[model samples]
Target: MKRCLDEAVLQAYLDGELSGDAALETQAHLAACSQCAAALNAAEGEGAFLAAAFAPDDSVNVPTVQLRARIDAAVARLDAQPETNARPSGGWNFGALLASFTSLLTFTPQRAAGFAGMLSCVVLAALFFSIQKPSPAPNSPAQEEHMAFVTQPPAQPKDGSANVEVKDAPTAPTPEINRSGVPIQVAKFNRPHASKPRVKAAPVASSLAAPVASKAQPLPGEKDYEQAIASLSTAISHGGDAVLKPQVRAQYERNLAVLDKAIEETRLVARRNPKDKDAVDFLMSAYQSKIELLTTVADQAQVAALGR
Candidate 1:
């Protein structure tokens, strides 16, 4: 930082590439170095000139009179063509229909009448079928058996209590009889407040589940990367925001979010199939990129502190 700053560095500074303390150092160096200050002014002038040269022209003149005239001419041409009550594309064309009708006149009256009657009958039949909806098929004996509602006959009390009528409860589901005359038992649902004895699950042998557990476990390399990332994150959180400018901190946060999402997605893919080389590669790449980003910020902070 003591040496004269290069034009490239100055350009990066002017372009806002130098963030947090790095930007402060550049500002301090520019203040003390008159030569650099002149160079900065020259850079600013060039930037302004380039921006002005590339600026879009807002004074483009549209030929309203010519456009209006062309539109009006098109409308006049459309109006000159006869519509003859024909549709634009899908419906029958009147001009073609007129030619067909003229050709039809060459046939004798009786032949023409017979042809017209046959065409009318076909058209009527098609219209009738298209307008009507198909009726549902009648249920067979098996379907009737499944769908029939069972109504038990009234029963008297077995205790001979003056013929008390016993009826099926309204809340109970209607049981249906199968084709073999066996009554199908309706599945009864337990009430929400019903207390039931919990059956202890049989102990699963470790050997049976060992392979699945091992498969779910992360690799040694991934574990190391995760530990390193966690440590770096903790260090950055301690004073990173204080050292970073608002804009730089925001940019870093956005980058971290994107990297985190990519890492999570790729990690799932890799976990689903460890043999997938592409997925493993993508996961590792995301981790590496995140590491590089954190490393860059940490180094930049360190360098800026040394300069101070």
Candidate 2:
């Protein structure tokens, strides 16, 4: 007997892909060969099972026309309705405000005159109140008495310095004519001598340079500096890239060491003489530089992380 047909030849024969003579030959071979016939039957059974499993159901019907009509009606109603360009209330819409202003501008001149007159009346009322002064209140008896005393002339001295009669000094005699025909008075009185006022001398620069108090006080924002230092230290410890390049780490360490030494020296000087403002300022500046360096390192670390 001939060898069993290839599974491909049998599948092609079942699918009607074989030529007429080849298909007839395959059918004869399958009828004479029980093994080939059983294989073909199994393939046919699998194909039918798959087809049945995936076939479309006849019971689940779709009403395409009705659904299409409903959708069309909804679309037609939407198209018929007018679209409104609504906006949120209380918003500053410049275009709308401008339109309103233009509408107002279209009014007749009489309305404009009325508006102007109303504005003028408001301005006039404001000016009247601003320019007017309150009426003065009547003075009390004591105030009147005080005013009278202040208006009274001062008493003349015994030396007759004023043009009033003095009790101890006699009045001037009638004027006599001099050789040049000018009238001259012949009375004389003793005048009191005025004393000079004593003046205080200005303070010397060396005396003004003396320290007023000795108790040491910290510089302004000292606590803020400490806080920044602590925060940056914590961030350096907990944050930044997991690993930094060796060279970068070395350079940052060197800078930190130099700043640390400088800060230490400044602290010593400030401790020796807490009143030394320059030393305190130097210490504060060193701290600020250290903070800046740490900040730079943190930034570089972030860059490195992002590159990664």
Candidate 3:
């Protein structure tokens, strides 16, 4: 600007809010002054960025008809609510409020009806209080009798009904207590041949247990486990005896011995109890262990070859 452009005016111009002679003058100044032009360009860039950044994500949503009308109506209703916060410009105006209230009290049918309704409410409340009976005082005989009735057991009826037990009110039943302090059921005393409290039998353990876990059953392929172990062992030994490190070779031999022993023991178990799931599982595991040992040695041999 010939005169440095005010930031606010420059902002307004960038927003396309400035018009007429002012806009024309701003355009001319921007063209002549590189500094103002740079500022205007920066402002434009910032405005564009802000607009894009805060823009509503409308791509995924279906456009609603009359969106502006709905928004405007909501804003109008918000503005129309009566404000309770009176302006503090004149401070408190008690006298003015009192005068207004007095004016409202002038004789009118509406006021008369309101007064009648209020008087009716007062009368009803007074009548309710007046009709309520007072409870007996603590020391009174009636109060004592009420307390005794609750705390003391009912007196047995005289006459022929003396043999019959009676209760003034049917109180909640209390369970019968045995000598051990356990609550036993209170069976009907009137029932014939009622002697002992029936005891519930303990639950028995079921024979079923998930048919043994899937892994606990024999592995698939009748001879596959045997073939796999043999093949893996042949692969490991084919690399030659001295190829393995001393410690590694010892460990491998030891593992093989253990696997062999496990296999023999499992075979014996399986032969004795072919139908036993545990024995079958043990036999399968022994074969798998041998296979794993062979695979480990084969991998080590390959690693050694790569190192060479």
Candidate 4:
């Protein structure tokens, strides 16, 4: 009897879906595994809470007046249409109307303007058609010349004593350019020599190296400053007693000024030593305080909007 239980088996047991030996085995596994036991307990508790919350109520029955109205409207529409056993009609017939409108437009005082527009349109259409046309079958004269040069067999050493005989290959015909002016070429290659081995390119280095982990250091006495700023911002934004009460507003301003001085000192330290983490931490704290100040000002605007 295997004592180990998978997540599904454990869930089924919790759900009371397993039977006999399988159920017993799951129960035994749960007893041994603390994590599984805790999960099963949570599931059972959730099930009990749901059962209590959604126990059926027979007293509530909402009417469907809106649903009934929609159904009636749809039925009425279907009843009004004539019966059709033939194939459905295709697209709308507007060819004659379009031709008449085009003819009228061509004869007006706007004819020159129309002709310029038409010519521009024709040029644009030709340009787009040329771009989309399958690139004219590589028939450029330069490409053909390069291919011929590469395919021409290497000149053999002139020796009557050599066993192998070399023959000159036939030249390819030049490609003719179309009036639209597009070039095309055919690529050619000579028989590869067995004596010379082809060298393949080396594999490139990987770009996805493990990133250096950066640990953010907590600035000393900065948390208190942030909390003060956050509190003042929240109070001003919400239009609470802080704005209406002079004493509270004065205290908020004083705390902000003190934090500003501390920030300046931190900035000076940072300027002296650029890589100091503490100085960087203090600068970030200052930025957080400035954000809070802006947030407070925006909130005051919202309060004014409410008055209007």
Model 2 stretches with alpha carbons more than 4 Å out:
1-218, 304-308
Count the clashes in each prediction: 0, 0, 0, 5
Question: In angstroms, what RMSD does candidate 3 have relative to the true structure?
Answer: 35.7
- What RMSD value applies to candidate 4? 44.2
What would the per-residue lDDT of candidate 2 be over residues 1-308, giving only the tens digit for each residue?
A: 89999889978977899998998888899899999999999989988997888677745688999999999999999999876655657788788889999988886899889889999999999999988968889663345445744675544334443343224444556778999999887776656555443333333333323322221344567668778888877777765635678887888889899998877656645644667787778888998999899887777666666677
User: Number of the top candidate by TM-score?
Assistant: 1
Worst 10 residues of 3 by lDDT: 202-211
Q: Per-residue CA lDDT of candidate 1, range 218-267, in tens?
A: 85489989988988777666534457788997998899999998887667
The TM-score of predicted model 1 comes to 0.31
Q: Can you give the TM-score per candidate against the true fold?
A: 0.31, 0.28, 0.27, 0.21
Question: Which portions of model 1 miss their true places by more than 4 Å?
Answer: 1-216, 305-308
Highest lDDT against the true fold, candidate? 1
lDDT of 3: 0.69
Order of candidate numbers by lDDT, starting with the best: 1, 2, 3, 4
* Candidate 2 local Cα displacement, residue 158, angstroms: 71
For candidate 4, write residues 148-228 as lDDT tens digits: 446755444344234343545566757667788886664665565445333432222121111101122334554666676
Whole-model lDDT for model 4 versus the true structure? 0.63
| Model 1 residue 130 lDDT score | 83
lDDT of 1: 0.75
